[model samples]
Target: MSTTVTQQPQHSTLGEYKRWLRVSLYTILLLTGQCTATLLGRFYFAKGGKSKWIATSVQSAGFPILIPLLFYSSKSTNHDFSKPKRSVMITFYLGFGLLMIAMDFLYSCGLSYLSLSTFALVCATQLAFNGVATYFLNSQKFTALILNSIVVLTMSVILIALNTESEDSTDLPKEKRLIGLFCALAASATFALQHSLLQFYFEKVAKTGVFSVLLRLNFYPMIIASVGAVVGLVGSGDWRSMGMEMKEFEYGNLELTITPILAVFVFHDKIYAVKIVAFFLAIWGFLSYIYQHYLDDQMANQDRSDDGLQVLKGEEQI
Candidate 1:
């Protein structure tokens, strides 16, 4: 008689759970930070603060927040992350830092003119930009759902562009509104490129471990960007006007306009039918991309489970 027995690997399940838990935590943190930062950044411009460089500086200058998290070591894993030479690391970090400065500066320009609602809607195109970057850079599969997302997002942009005159989010002129649109789109594209470069660096060059990820990908580059922002601030002499800008600005709610809905009440941003349509389209596109990502994650986990089962079966062989 022949008998076969198998034992499930409990460790694999635990590890997968931990990985997902970490991912969830990171996602929540990122979302919170983005909303908070956007609200405050837009607030700066809303109150007649004109220095784009200062706003740009504040974005990356908050690198100190990551210090404790970055330094906290965790137990080692089987994955051996690459450790590039210091000089090489410097070059890589500087490249990203410069790119980030330009990205932030453009975003600042966008916020300076566009209302919070309009700005947020434009920012939604960021994911669409990432989709394009992934298609070209990683050669990721062009699935139907993802294509739908990209097309829908493009339509959202067109919706806004078509009704340029009546979509008055702010008291700004049509020319300034157009400028905001351009700046926001440019910033989105720049951010997509930055994201692609970061992924490429981690996957191909750095192979940085999860624990040390922020140090190279964000901390170093942000420090360099902060310096660039400061230099621009001083060089442009915008720092001189900041004192009066802050003093003369009319003060209002601190956390009032955290979203587009709130912007109607807080910033008095006008709502147009076209913008309403665009917002819905943007939301649909965003949801489509998120669903596609969820599907991708499911497939990845299933493959990992299959590999783990194969290993466990081999080990249990009689």
Candidate 2:
């Protein structure tokens, strides 16, 4: 009669709880990282850090920090680094590096000219740019919802721009305001294009373990960007400006470091909706835009099929 009472482990429930906790932590970290980067960029710009190249160089420094992680990851994972040839990789990185130089330069110029709040608000239009860029670059389908999002987002930016026109409240000069507006729009466009291109490369070219891809993506670009930044700094004779920029650089650096971690580890993606209709409208617009693109693609394919059928009929008649 030596039957002992045994307790079963609640492994499934415990594992689920751990998973939920991890997701929550990751979400918070990502939000924090994004906010930190934004604030730091604004701070650097507001603090008279006008040299875009120098600021870009400082931001690019984060890539080097990943060297150890990249090495460790390569050692630990069975990743094939030889898939993308060195020359091809260099070309890709150089192209993107040049684009990034322009984008960062425009962003810096915008920040220097516009108030932080105005610049940030204008930058929000990047989503619309992204929508268009993705459609062209990746053949991303645009649905009605996506269109709605783009419209709403674009309207919001327009409203902000209109409000900024009434310069009674601020001391910014008209010329500077105009320049800032142009720079912000240009930056958004370039950023959207670059983002779309990056996504394309990540999906098609970076067909390896995440670490190997990240290393190639970040490190090589940094080299070109660093060179560009150095030349800009030297050309502008603003080598001394880097010290002030570095003072506020830590926040941006922290953001850069945390972003990749969140991207890799975070599993549960959540969108918390507010009571604002604009927010919902933007979300729906994005959905619609994507759907519309899909519809366009389907229509194009159908047209191609019809053309092929007509060609076959003509051949038969002949």
TM-score of each: 0.86, 0.66
Among these predicted structures, which one has the highest lDDT?
A: 1
lDDT of 1 by residue, 192-252 (tens): 9888877887777777647576464788899899999999999999999877766765553
Question: Residue by residue across 174-237, what tens digits does model 2's lDDT show?
Answer: 7777788789889999989988988888777765547667676777777777788778888887
RMSD of 2: 12.7
Off by over 4 Å in 1: 1-18, 74-81, 165-167, 252-265, 312-318
- List the lowest-lDDT window of 10 residues for candidate 2: 1-10
Alpha-carbon local distance difference test for all models: 0.81, 0.67
Candidate 1, run of 10 with poorest lDDT: 1-10
